[model samples]
Target: MGDNEAPARRVVADYARPNAANARSSITRPAIGVNRLQIPPQIITMVTNTIQFHGLPSEDPNVHLSRFSAICDTFQEQGVTEDACKLRLFPFSLADRAHAWLESLPAGSITTWAGMKEKFLDKYFPPSKIARLRSMIQEFRQKPHVGGDAEAEPGDNEAASRDPGSADTVTDSVHDQRGGTTSGEPVAILGA
Candidate 1:
């Protein structure tokens, strides 16, 4: 009785990576799961179509930041919610890119959040609500000032909550600093 044989067990659920035994199963993983939808129906949240538009190819090898900026601009142009941009920045590189782009915007470009938001919503959004999208985006991008790719991730939910779909991302998809869904695979949604 000193050493008794025990049956080995393995958890078959939540199999993200491929399993040799289940080679025929093709249930792909989702970026965001339904269980994570913290907000209920009727709760106001920004649309997270951050990738709504794409920019032209960059000839420079260091265009990672620039590309990310281009993606952010896409959200602005397509009337997409800034929440998507904020969520996309959670992985750091995009946020850094966003920060760079925002910083580069002409100084005083957003002199008054209230006023600029009025204009932003006037054209992009309706009902005269969500008057802080522009500033919120600016703040998200401005967080990683000068800390582009050299810092450890603080793992803040700021990006996740704003753009839940973007948290835990693996793509530098915009610039691909990390990669894209090919990278780590995010787990939030609606720009969280």
Candidate 2:
């Protein structure tokens, strides 16, 4: 009855725990399931990389990727130019892990974007970046003793500067669907 005191709260009687009732719990993703939509002709081939995305909140990887592509298209249409749209571009697993890690941290502690990145790195990133670091390393496992191996020529840089469409480096994975495996992922990753 004092000003400093608060009334006692009680749990609702209807609430029931599944474990107590001998019931099972499961997770689901409705967005990834069968939906009426055309498969995208364009696919992003991440060579020598692994992207961990949050697949639980999302169901279809293709659908999520399409949304990311749409955001890119919107930015291009608005005449705003930049590199890859890092905002929407996240690895499925990394996103989920980052989300969980952030939730674990005390509120307001994640004050800056860099803080989030640091925590994300501390939680998920390996000695190197990306989900498939081992595969990326293996991609370069062969002969490469030269200093200028990774560097490109001036003309090659100009060619690389062109808009992303059917680049030779990534073309094989994107268009290989004709001979590519349609059984698993729509976009088959290379070196990952």
Candidate 3:
């Protein structure tokens, strides 16, 4: 190769290309069945109105996921799978920081509804948060009732025991980090 022509060589540093973020989606779309399935605008609007997660510290990601799943359950198309419906409508429920977090995920990383749920919970409801909640549950103690009569009558106690939904009893909705309630039973406390 002549020096004047410059030997054909590989360029080590290539010029920057256009950003592809806008062109690609983080969540993978399900394969279209025999008939193409589409979520209705009304369903999207309903989910948006009912659930909004901003990724705030106060927001419970589990609760948000549960609620979102519930809303997604309301509508079902013949060709659409449950996860397909969830994956489609889940994005509309996110706002502010939550939406940003979703956008930050790598393109095509989430292929299934399970993957999306896992990623969301791993980000928002981290292990540290779960530990903290678990610790709180372990350290929970009922505070003595004030202002009201400290001691209830024997008859009142009997009535409260018979009625599972009595005001005298308090039930803790301590969510198990892995799934549903830690224990589905109510923690009974007698007023004293």
Candidate 4:
């Protein structure tokens, strides 16, 4: 072959080779009992438009999966299972880092929605983050409001701030309906 023809033949040979990327799939699409499982294009568009998980720290994987499952539930075909629809459409909702993470999973590893959800949550909202949130919840305590409405609960500053005499500053005992006083100390009823 001539020099120019050799380069053209090489290009054709490269094109003829099987694409390794297409040989393996991260998600195993379930066999829908029906012969034809037709998913409307509009439905796919709705999912892509409604929610996308980009793997951001602020993005909650639980919320993302919840929304995704809700959307998947809407797609009810006669013979196709909800899981089948989710398997096909879930990929359309992932973008940026989230899409990359899904693509990186081993071929045929995620066979079900539950498996995908577990992997996604474990990767994003790990045990360390869950423990920290639980700890914060256990430690949370409402601080005393220290001022405002006489009828307000000791620590309910949100309710007291709405009153006209919200500037009032006094002891928690004075705010109580039961005529209890603390150390008999004089309190400012309005304007600190």
Candidates in descending TM-score order: 4, 3, 2, 1
Model 2, stretches more than 4 Å misplaced? 1-52, 55-97, 128-192
| Predicted structure with the largest lDDT when compared to the true one | 4
Cα deviation of 29 in candidate 1 (Å)? 17
Candidate of highest TM-score: 4
Backbone steric clashes in candidate 3, count: 0
Rank candidates, lDDT, best first.
Answer: 4, 3, 2, 1
Where does candidate 3 clash, by residue pair? none
* Candidate 2 colliding pairs, count: 11
Specify the poorest-scoring 10-residue window by lDDT in model 3: 169-178
Per-model TM-score, in order, reads 0.16, 0.26, 0.63, 0.67
Model 1, span 136-164: residue lDDT tens: 66677545523234343555323323543
> What is candidate 3's lDDT per residue for 68-183, written digit by digit as tens?
88877777788778777787778899999999888888988988999998999999989998899899999999998532457756654443344566543323212333255566
Tens digit of per-residue lDDT, candidate 2, span 1-192 = 899998776577545534456432111112222233222223233311233345353344445444544543543312222221232233222355444554456644543324444554454454444546577877875665232335544453343345566554433444564575445544433322
Better structure of 2 and 3 per lDDT: 3
lDDT of 4 by residue, 29-114 (tens): 99999998888888889888989889999999999989988877776899887778888899999999999999999999999988
Q: How big is the positional error of residue 76 in model 1, measured in Å on the Cα after superposition?
A: 3.8
